[model samples]
Target: MPPSTVNRQWLLERRPVGAVAAEDFRFNEADIPVPTDGEVLVRSLYFGYDASQRIWLTDDGGYMEPIRIGEPMRTMGIGQVVASRDPGYQVGDLVEGFLSWQDYVLARGDGPMPLRVLPPADHPLSWHLGVFGVGGLTAYFGITDGLQVKPGDTVVVSAATGATGSLAVQIAKALGAKRVIGTAGGEEKCRWVVEKTGCDVAIDYKTDNLDARLRELCPDGVDAYFDNVGGDMLDTMLLHMNPLGRVLICGAMSSGYCDVKMQGPSNYMRICTYQLTVRGILLFFYRDRLAEGAAQLGEWVREGRLHVEEHVVEGFEHAPALLPTMFTGKQPGKLILKVADPD
Candidate 1:
């Protein structure tokens, strides 16, 4: 980082009442600060845009404390160290962590460096922020550990066209599911899931009869349900669950956005009737096993068994506009904002 360089940041302006507004996030430009002692200054390369980012804006907050008003929005980013004062990270070491929506950041210590120097080479650099990143790891662990997909089990994934669900559906196939089913919105997403993503069937939950379609797709019963979109879709999936079924509660995008009472599942009692095992995943809980998850996903990517789709957005100027794309179904796959090219 040079003293003359200017850093642009997307700061949280105000918490939103419902859907994120352009005014909720405001942009600012500042001089790039130099790395202090025991710190590394990195140039931001990419940003990971997850649905959970919306929840992070709420007053009550989700998982972690909400991003403070008028501060740089907290996000996962891939970056390359431009200057180093830390022993752990060298100049040009590719790392991923709590990099904000800014052009440059000061990584102070190991606390900020979770996964170090491990960007994808076989695939594009964006994969490190998408498929081989947190979203991909969520699908891998949520399936392999949370759901534990078996050779002949019937597995279903909600929001199957989204980042985590899409990967989860394919991982189940790679793990040898007898039948892999997905629930996506609209014809294009449904067709893409079944035809391109290798799911046995795709239920267009927006227009189709979910109950009828699930029954047709999983004749025996749904052995595992990898849920991303919660609310009514979850309730329907629950009704068709097999005995001793596994439900990986990867995310509740709907319940997080809407009033929980209005959108909450009514068929939760099915969990008791079916003797289903339900596990919620937060990704951070499996921090110790991230390497194992990444290695396997990377291998699957190399073998062409796993395919990753990244909806890459360029420029720091577009950061505020891109944040709203996730909630509106405008983004095609995993959303990543590319800020700077690696030198």
Candidate 2:
């Protein structure tokens, strides 16, 4: 079959106020981009919609520059090299990297070192978004560096059933966390966290009294906290930290979309008194150490020492709906959008 002449993509209509509305983004089509000299045309297979990118949209100047108004929205996607003008990539070779939210991506060979294509491991394709991809890498680094939880140390993760948190739970257990405590929004998510990750304690914030439950679970006080959702959960956990405890602040989804001012934790002052260490983490900021993380996580997955959670949405048009699910805290695991071949 012949390749299509047009490419479809989602473009920003306006900067979002709070929660993004359907009208905030527009679907547009362009002539399928031709690969210039030293470039490759990639047909996107899967697109990632994560909380980190959403945070980028909300504010300017994080690590990378913000997506300018009226431009194609940015995301991380995996695709196959369909046509190449560069010797490095051949037709049908798979690659993953920062991409526009579109069905076809033109990767500049001269652009920042393109992520090398690798043989798909024993896991499902969606694993690239969940356990084996950036989500997994965050979990891997948080446990190893940010928290430095030892084999017998008790570890707790907030947003416990989401993409990164779910994997963190499993990784902690794999590394021998004596007690793995997970805090999720509801009974269903909490139960899944416990069952899937074999966590020692799972708290459903929707029903459980967080302070009371956490105190009971970690009678010795928590050794490490891998926090994804911040706000009150952080406040509650701070009060329960053991002396010299470590905290990794990975996300603050609870405060991300609010129009009003977010509340700060009064208990945060306890950090000095308890000798607590808190580090706010942006996974991409540690891209220099990505190889170290991928090596450890990949080995674990290959040996069946880790499990991946994935939710695959077919078709590129479904990209906009993916983010709101994360905002509402409704999506299960990592969310990926599947696109058809370019031809």
Candidate 3:
């Protein structure tokens, strides 16, 4: 078969404020790139659309560099190695890496997460972009290894319906958390979080009063909190923290798109009063330990102990419109875009 000829990509047009707008992204098409001596040509199959990308656009102090304006947006994708000049990889190998949001990627195999062959077909390739991927690794580290939730302890998760949060809830329960409570935006999302993640209690932050609802659901106070959406959510959750409660700070999704200035948590004093331990986790900072985390998550997936929900959108051309869906709470699970399901 002849090699592919072109690639379509979504480029960053502008930085977003408060919420990402449509004009912030632009689509570009270019000739298929030929690989150098040690590189390969990868045809993208599944690409992740995570809420964390919003934070990546900002030049904030982070583990990774921000995606420059006018450049192809950065993403983690699963692809089949259609062509390779590198000794480490061969043609027809399936791999996952930080590929572009494009139909084809000229992978140099030099990125932080260089292309690695995909797992068994029975394991589901999409998991490389979500659960069993970065999201799952993050959840595993933050909960089991970071917070150390024990059996019969109360565990609460914010952004509970989201990709990482949902997995955290499940992992917490799987580790024997006596009660797992999740907080989400709407009634539907709250229900979905509990139903899918097997959380013991679910609260709708939109409809329920934060302090009161948390008190009602967790009368004994929260023992551990897996925080994904920061801002007011953290403040409320902090107010109900039990003595010696451990909080794993995951992502700041609530403020990821806030170009406008926003207030930090108002109840931070509670952390001192309750003698709480808050740990901020950036997955990249733990890259050396990712394989260990992935192994645990993979075991859970194989045993059917972990359930992953993937909300996939189709086409690279549709990526511009789809990336903003994470902020609107429209994506039910790990948001991904099927750039090319080419046969």
Candidate 4:
């Protein structure tokens, strides 16, 4: 006989202060859910930690409502349906949504996290959590729709070795940027971004002087800045930007730091003087049109034009601790927590 399975989850115990800790979340097990009418029970496979999810943990949640005490931590993940009460979905269907930090999710077909079926398991489910999901699409649109990069343009992507940053570096090249520079916090990551992601120059911010390096790397001035690490990096890049430069605001690594220590950017004047265009992008805005980019990125990955990486961890127990690494820049790539495999 098969062993009994239970749904294990982490509930928010309290809001995080500096770095997220195990004390902030309480883990417990519950009976695997039975789907009601129009609901499907999806057994989660791989869940990923996004930098934005940290914003939801704070009392002042920026975009969406904050996760309250005693609520399941909101995360994006992929799962295979084990049982179903909805005609639109059936058993064995892999789905994607705001699957929480848990083993299973009972989702309605039309809920806020509407039950959308995923592509067949051609690649690892983690890829769905990457290029096929938010990371690749964010780069696709952030470049095509936001920056509109051109040949001979210099595009510098901060957090270059990250899931999104890695893709952005490659996509910038494919989109005709003659020079693509990436920034990471360490030498190992810096080397990976250049060697693996094909970035023309990789700056290790932890060791090198970023301002001095940027001045040296882009003597013509930065034509486009794809900012993922926003703090002093953003300010320094701002000072080096050429006229008509565009700054794409994908993530704010700085805003969160300031939230802890109370600080803001000192580079507004540079933006004004350079006549730069600054627009903050939200993937939610591209919801309906997401497949266009996802398909393109999927083709690129399959064609070996771009590569995607995952910083995968096994089991749900380590999730709380694993999430803090993104903030600290210790994670290697798109951080995926593998929970289970498809039946």
What order do you get sorting by lDDT, best first?
A: 1, 4, 3, 2
Output the TM-score of candidate 4. Answer: 0.93
Clashes of each: 0, 0, 0, 0
Determine the C-alpha RMSD for candidate 3 after optimal superposition of all C-alphas. 2.4
Give the clashing residue pairs of candidate 2, or none: none
As for TM-score, the candidate ahead, 2 or 3, is 3
As for TM-score, the candidate ahead, 2 or 4, is: 4
Q: After superposition, how far is residue 293 of candidate 1 from its true place, in Å?
A: 1.2
Q: Taking the tens digit of each residue's C-alpha lDDT, what string does model 3 give over 1-343?
A: 2236767778889876657776788878788887889889888888887776776777561456878888788788888887898988878788887887777788876656667776565666788888878888889889977899999899998888888889999999989999998888887887788778898878887888888888788889889999887888898889889999999888887776554245779899988998999998777677677778878888888888887899877656677787778887675678887766534
lDDT comparing candidate 2 with the true structure: 0.79
Per-model TM against the reference = 0.94, 0.91, 0.92, 0.93
- Give the root-mean-square deviation of each candidate in angstroms: 2.2, 2.6, 2.4, 2.3
- For each candidate, what is the lDDT? 0.82, 0.79, 0.81, 0.82
* Backbone collision tally, model 3: 0
Per-residue lDDT over 158-207 for candidate 4, one digit per residue giving the tens place of the 0 to 100 score: 88887888898999998889999998878788888888889998999889
Q: After superposition, how far is residue 293 of candidate 3 from its true place, in Å?
A: 2.5
lDDT of 4 at 37: 85
User: Residue 22 lDDT in model 2?
Assistant: 57
Point out the worst 10-residue segment of candidate 4 by lDDT: 255-264
Where does the lowest 10-residue lDDT sum fall in candidate 1? 255-264
